[model samples]
Target: MASYECNRDFPVEIIPSSCARHSIKCRKIIVEKIRRDRISNSIEELRTLLQTNQTNQCPEQPSARLEKADILEMAVQFLREQASSKSNESYQSGFSHCLQETLRHLSLHAPLQPAEREQIKRFYVHQRTSMHTRLSTEPRAQFCMPSKRHSTLRVRKSLWRPW
Candidate 1:
């Protein structure tokens, strides 16, 4: 049977031979480098320990945070792919139109804080303007235009419009 030490010390040289060739002071350099490396390694080890402890203490799913992050990232990538794949004029126009509609829908239903509400309002206005521009450029696209009532109504009234 072989015995193994979990925490083994390794010899590390902090000063390079080039420092001696340049006649630079080596002792202080060596001490400082060693200290810096020690502190860095300690911090990394502490972080690993903390992460391990957190995982071990949790009774629920181990990778919930990672999974959520992955899902969000995947959704973003899917949106990007869809946007990038629309090379044709009609596809680009239609995609923008649909995006504007989705944003408008989200603004109506999503629970938003005051600041978030302001941000959403700004985005909605911008998207509406972009939608108008796209519709102006391509008048034949029926689905891209806001309905008569929706186009005339104020934002508040538009919010009340049935889904």
Candidate 2:
């Protein structure tokens, strides 16, 4: 493969231990204080959004150990909603930002299940195939003919060899 000739090596460097933790801690504490003052963006809010049956004023504490299965299921619904509402860019962006932030916080404290990796892979594939039609077509164009077979042919080609 001639892999050894490729530029894969890295130049090593050393740094003082204080350079890493202290600055990060200082920045985090500053942001953390501001967050305490704000009253928006809570896990309870997400649980409320995801739950269909529950009323707004539930007097129960949620389990801190949220299951990966539940999270993945909710994520599937969220992504589907985003993928379907392709006309609205702002809504999708806002939802994506919120989702990423929530996931970042959760991932720091919780470990994902072994099955979650496969779940994520499946989601990626689904989104890619389904969104290909919407994203590949030109936007802001005049009315065009709706040829069903044209789209299907492209999809089949992608499915066979996406290389």
Candidate 3:
């Protein structure tokens, strides 16, 4: 095999020897070394990858220094954080929703007449207790999960006063 030009896209320069086979052999060895070196073994490589991912789209194919296990671990941690954040958000939303309903009902009634006020208070207290109990007893992983539908109720107000 006669010596030929190497592909312009290759990052490392393979010495253009008289024989193309020798150049190809050298390139293969270089790639092999890169693959054998894990990102965990080199702090610099890990930093560079983290920076690249944070800044922009990485090149079409990154260096083989990034191990499959490292990538999988990162993905798992990200999903865990996402789940925890979602649980907190759902819990807050449910609590706020219960409060909002209670307030809206009371507001519409204006000044409640004692018995009616007591009834509304009891209803709100029951909802609050149920929410608190569920939040406390549920597993951390399952805490504060939203319903499958993920829908919110919209409130429309005050079109009665002639826009």
Q: Largest lDDT belongs to which candidate?
A: 3
- Residues 1-163, candidate 2: write the lDDT tens digits: 1112212253333233343455566788889987965523444455556553222223253434344455445545455545644744564466457756766776778976768756755765675556555544522110121234654564455443345
Which lDDT values do the candidates have, in the order given? Answer: 0.49, 0.48, 0.53
Candidate 3 per-residue C-alpha lDDT over 18-93 given as tens digits, one digit per residue, 9 for 90 to 100: 3367667779989888877754455455546543653343344444554555554444443564675577559658
Off-target runs (Cα >4 Å) in candidate 3 are 1-81, 87-91, 94-98, 132-163
TM-scores for all candidates? 0.23, 0.26, 0.35
Which stretches of candidate 2 lie above 4 Å from their native place?
Answer: 1-87, 138-142, 145-163
lDDT of 2 at 18: 41
For model 1, residues 36-104, the per-residue Cα lDDT tens digits are: 999767655554543464345443535333333433443344344345345334654775688668767
Among all windows of ten consecutive residues in candidate 2, which has the lowest summed lDDT? 138-147
Worst ten in a row by lDDT for model 3: 151-160
- Pairs in clash, predicted candidate 3: none
